[model samples]
Target chain A: MAYALMIHPTDNVAVVTEAVRPGEDVLYEDANGGQVCLKAAGDVPVYHKIALRDIAPGEQVLKYGKTIGVATAPIAKGEHVHCHNIESPERKELI
Target chain B: MEFYGYRRSDGRVGIRNHVLILPASICASDTAEMIARQVNGAVSFHNQVGCSQVPSDMQYALDMMAGLAANPNVYGTIVVAAGCETCQCGMVMDAIAARTNKPLHGLIIQKEGGTIRLIEKAVRLAREMAAEASTLRREKFPVSELILGTECGGSDPTSGIAANPVIGKVSDALVADGGTVILSETTEFIGAESILADRAKDEHVRRRILEIVERYEQHFIRNGENVRLGNPTPGNKEGGLSTLEEKSLGCIHKGGESVIQAVYDYAKPIPTDVKGLVIMDTPGNDASSIAGMLAGGAQIVVFSSGRGTPLGSPIAPVIKITGNDATFRMMEDNIDFNAAPVITEQKKPAQLGEALYKMVLDCCDGKLSKAEALGFTETAVMRACNYV
Candidate 1:
C-alpha cells in the first residue's frame, strides 16, 4: 500500500507517507472505516495532503478532526490540497 | 512514579544542581557570565533586553530574573548588578527570596568600586556557591511533584500527525499522575482557541483562555501588523503547513486532552495546587515562550518540533521530540526523541507516550539529553512590546 493516514474520522484529507506521482494508485481507510482507492490526479509531495473525497468550494477542509481551513476552489479526490486551494478564515481575522 | 533529583530547601525538587550567576540588567550580563566561567558547576545566561523599559516590560524582566533564580535547577543564585540599572541588585534578590529560599547573594559594581573588584568578588562568591552546590546529593522524589512545560517551534504537518499528539498523550499521563503541565504560546491559539476552551473545566478558565488569545491578536492589530504574516513561519510553510490555523490546530495538541484549570500571565509562578493543564499567555518566539513557562515553574520542558530548532535552557532540560524522521536523522544531535513511527503505524501514540514519559524520568535522574550533552543553554525574557 502506497499508504496515507486519515488522522480523524471527520477529516476529508489524507497525508501521504511519500511523494505520489500523478496517476499512481493510493489507498485510504478513513476514520469511519470508509475505504478509498484512486489514481492520483496530481503530484502529492511527502507530508502534503490529498483530498479523500470531492469537496465543494467554500466547504470546510477537515484534518486532525478539526477545521484546518475552507476550500478556495472545488477539489477532487486525489488532488493536492495546499495553501493555494484553501484559506484559514479564523487566522485571517481577529475580534 | 519517582526519580532522583536535588530536593530544594523550599520543598521544590530540582533535576540539576548548579550555582547560577544572574545578571540584573544587560550591562552586568557579561560580568556575570565571566564569573560563572571561572567557577565549575556554575552556569549563566546573558540578559539581552535593554534594562530601562516601561512598567509592564520591567515587570516581565523582574519576574523572569526572579524565576530563573528560584528555579529548582539552581542550588544557589548570585545576582550581579551594573549598579545604575532599573532592576537593582537588592530588589532582584528580594524578589527571588519571596519565591525560593535557596541561597541568594547580591552584588553591585559601583558599590564594589570597579570591574576588577566586582569580578574578583563575584567569582569568589560563585566558587563558594558551586562548592556548596556540589556537596548536595540527589534524592528520589515523586513524579507528582513535577511541573512540566510544553511548547513547539518550526512546526509542520507531522507536528499534528505525530510529534505533538504524542506529547498530548504525555501531558495526559502526567496530569493523570497529578502533575502540572503548562501549555503556552498564545499566538498559536488563534484559530483553535474555542476548541481548547472546550477542554477547560469551567467557563471562567475557558473565558480567560479566549481572552488571552484575543488580547494577543489585538496587540498585533493595534501595532499595525498582521499576526498571520510571521506565524506558521517560513519553515512551517515549506513543510506543508498552509496557514496559522493549520499550525495552531497542530500546535495545541501538546496540551493533550486534560482540562485547562487556569490561565496565567507570562512569568508568573503557577500555584502548586493546580495539577492539571494550564495556559500561560506567551509570545510565539521559541525561547521566549519556553522562558515564560520556566519562570512559571516548569521543572522540565518537552518541546515538539518538525523543522527542528536547537533551543535549550540553563535552568531546565528541554527534551526535543519530532515526528519528522528526516529532521530527526538530520538533527539527531539536537533532537532527543524520534516519534515518526506513529505516522508509519510502527508505534502507537500511547506506546511512544509511555516511552517518552520514561525518558522524562530518566532525564530527571541525570540522563544528559542531546542538548545538554552538546552544552547548548539559551534563555530570553519575553517582552510585551519593544522598548519605548
Candidate 2:
C-alpha cells in the first residue's frame, strides 16, 4: 500500500508519500492508528494531492483544511489534483 | 536553554564574532570583498544599491548597511564608500553608532586615492578588529536572549507537511522559553492573512497584520501587476503547490501556533524587549527577505527549503532544513537538517523538532552551518522604488 498524509482533519485531499501508479491503493494513517484507503484513478507523483471525494467545478479544493484553489473541472475521488485542474481564485480578480 | 555566545557592548548576544567589511555603495563593494578576504573571520557581500537611488530607496540601503553592522553577530564594522555615492560612509557609520557603541571605522576611496589604498587601509582595520574580536571569550547566555528569524523558500508539499511543521514546534518551544521569533515574507501571507490575524496578541497587532497584507497587495496592484503572476512559480507547481493559498498555508507553518506580538516594517530593528512571535513586512524573494531579518537583529536564522538551497547570510548563519528526502539526499552538502523521516518513516514531528532544537543550539554554540562552511554569503537589500 502506498502511503499518504492528511495534514488536517477538514482537508478534503491528502498528499501522497510516494508516487502512486494508476489503480494503486493509497493508504492514509490517522493519529489514532485508524486507516483510510482510496484507489488511485491515475498516476499521482509523490508529494502531489489526491482527492478524497468527487469535487465539482467551482468547488473549493481543500488542503491543510483551507482553500488552496477552486477546481476547474470534474474531479473524481482519488484523481490527481494539481494546477491543470485547479486555479487560484485570487488570480481571477487581477488577471 | 543556555549556549555559548559573544555578548556585545549593547547587551545583545551574538552567535558569531565576525568582523564586517561593510560597503556603503556598489562602487566600494569590490574593495570591501578584497579587504574581507585578507582578514580572518571577516565577511562582506556585494551591495548593488546605494548610488543613483532616490532618497527613499537610498534610505533602505543605508538602513540595511547600518543595521547589518549593528547586528550582534559582528564584532565591529569597517564602512567603505566611494566619496561621490549617495550613501556616504559617514552617514552609514553614524547609523551604526546610533544603534550600538560597537567598534566602527570609516573609509572613502577618494580620500585614500583608489581601490588599492582603500583595500590596504580596510584590511588593516579589519585585521585589528578581528584580533580584538578573537580576544573576547564566549559566555553562556540563555536561549531567551536570541531573536530567531524564520524563512522558507523553494517550497513543496513535503515542506508544509514535515519541515515547516517541525519548525513550528521549534518556534513554539523558543517562544515558550521567552525568545523572539520573526515570521516574514508578506507575499506568501497573501491568502492566509485572516488565519494569521486571528492569532494576533492584541487588536493593534491584529489590525497591523491585515494592513501589511493589504499594503503588499495594493503595492503590486498599483504597479499594474499581480503577485499571483509569479508566486507558486513553476517549481512550486511541480512540487504540488497549485495556488498561492496552498503555498501560504504551508509558509505560515514556520511561525508555529504562537500568537503574534508585533508587526514591523522591512529592515527595521526588532527591539530587544519584544518577545514571542512577530511579523516583519517583507517581500518573498529569498535573499532579500533573509537580509531584512538579519538587519532586524536576528542572531541566527532557520530556513526551510523543500527544493533545497545553499543560501547563507553575510551577518549570521542560516540553518537549512528540508522535508524532501530526495532533495536532502541530493543536496546534503548545502542542507543542514533532514525532516523527511516525518513522512517516510512516520517519525513524530515533535521528536524531530527536539533534535532540530539541539542543532540550533549547537549552531549558536559555534557550529558552522553547511552554507557557512562553504562561504555562501549571498546578500540583497529591499528597495522601495526605482532609481531616479
Candidate 3:
C-alpha cells in the first residue's frame, strides 16, 4: 500500500510523494493513530495534491499548514486539487 | 565536507579564481572590457551605471563596484574610470580598501589622456593583477563558509510544488550545517509578507519585514502604477500562474522554515556571522537580484524555474533547477538539475533536496555547472533611474 503524506496535520490535502496507481491501496494515518484506507483514483504524480477531506465552495484550502487558495466548488476526498477547483484571492477575476 | 577554495588574505573563501577589471562609470566600460580582452583570466561586466545624478544612487554604484572587488571570488581587481563620474576611481578604490586589502590597481581614462592610452594602461595593470591572481592556490574550507543565495524565476504551477520547496529543504539543510542562505526578491514577497514576518525572530525583525514590503509597493506608487496591478508576469501566466499572491506564496518557500535574521538594502554586504536565512531587499529582475546577492557575499546561487531560464552570474556559479517536466525536457542544456522528478515522478522534496545539497558540494569542489561550462558570465547592478 502506498499513500501521499501531509507534512502538517492542519493541511487540507496530502501531497502525492509517490505515484499512486488506480486500484492500489492507499493508507493514511491521522494524528491519533487512526488509519484510513482508500484506493487510488488514478496515477497521481509526485508533488500533486490528493484531497483528505471534502471541501466546499469558498473554503480555504490548506497545504503545508498554510492557506494556498479558496475552493471554488465541492471536492471529494482523494480528488486531485489544483487550479480547476481553487482560485487565488489576488486574481479572482481569472476564476 | 570541504571544498578547495581560494582563501583570501581577509579570511574569506572564494570558489572562483579570477582577475576583475571593474569600470567605475559607463564611459570606462569599453576600456575595461578591452583590457580584460587583452589579458587571460580577466573578466569584466559591461556596466551602464556609476555616472549618475543622485548621490544615493552614486553611492549604490560605488558600493556595488567595491563589493564585487572585495568578493572572495576575485583574487585582485583593476578599476577603470573616466575620472569625471560621480563614483570616481579614487572613491571606488577607497571603498574596496575599506572592505578588503586585496591587490587593487586603478586606471583613469581622462587622466591617462585618451581611449587608446587608457586601454593600454588598464591592460598593463590588468595583466599584472591577472598574473598576481594566478599565483593564489585553492585551500580546504568547510561547507559552513558557503553563503548560498536562493531565487526563483520563470515560475509555473510546478514551481511551488517541486523546485521551490526542494530548494527550501536544501536551505534548511544548509542552515542546519551552519551555512548562510539569502532569500531575496522583495516584489515576490508582497502577498506573503505576513507569513514571512511571522517567522521573524522578534517583533522588530517582523516589523522590518513589513516595512520592506511597504517600501517596494511605494516604489510602484511613486511611478504612478497601481500597487496590485498584477505582477506574476506574462511568462508566469503562460506557465499557469495566475496571480501575484499565488506566486508570492510559492516564492516564500525558498526561505525554508528558518528564522528570518536580518534585512538588507540592494548590494549591501550581509553580516557574515548571521546564520540561518536572511532576506535582501532586491527587485524581481533575475539578473539584478542575483547581482545583489553576489554583492552581498553569496558565493553560489541556486536558481529555480518552472518555465526555465539560462541566466548566470559573472562572479558566482548559478545552478539552474526546474520543476516542470516539459520545461526541463525543452531546455535540457540550460537547466543543471531536474527537480521535475518531484512533480512528474515520485521523488520527495527532502530526497531531491539532499541531491541538491550534494550538487552544491560538488559545485563547491570545482564541478562545472551548466552555466560555468557554457561560459555564461552575466552581471548587472540595479540602477535607480532608467537608461535612455
Give fnat, all candidates.
Answer: 0.52, 0.73, 0.08
TM-score of each: 0.96, 0.97, 0.84
Q: What residue runs in model 1 are displaced by over 4 Å at the alpha carbon?
A: A90-95
Candidate 1, residues B1-388, lDDT tens digits: the string is 8889888898888898989899898898888888888998888887876377888888898899888888888899999998888887887888899999999999998899977899998889888988888888888788888999999998889988899989999999999988999999998998899898888889888888888998888888899988888887788878888878888988999999988999999999887777888999999888888888888878899999999988898778999999999999999989999999998765888899999999988998999877777777788878777766
Candidate 3, B357-384: lDDT as tens digits: 9998889877878987887767777666
DockQ for every prediction shown: 0.55, 0.54, 0.13
The sequence of per-residue lDDT tens digits that candidate 2 reaches over residues B1-388 is 8989999999999999999999888899998999999998899999999899998788888878888999999999999999899998888888888899999999999999999988887888888899999999999998899999999999999888899999999999999999999999999997788899999999999999888888878888899988888998888889888888899999999999999999999888899999999999888888988998989999999999998888998778899999999999999999999999999888988999999989999999999989899999989887777777
Clashing pairs in 1: none
Better by DockQ, candidate 3 or 2: 2
Pairs with steric clashes in candidate 2: none
- Clash count for candidate 3 is 0
User: Worst lDDT window (10 residues) for model 3 chain B?
Assistant: B237-246
Model 1, global lDDT? 0.87
* Candidate order by decreasing TM-score: 2, 1, 3
- Chain A TM-score of candidate 3 vs. true chain A: 0.76
List iRMS for all predictions: 2.1, 3.9, 7.3
DockQ of candidate 1? 0.55
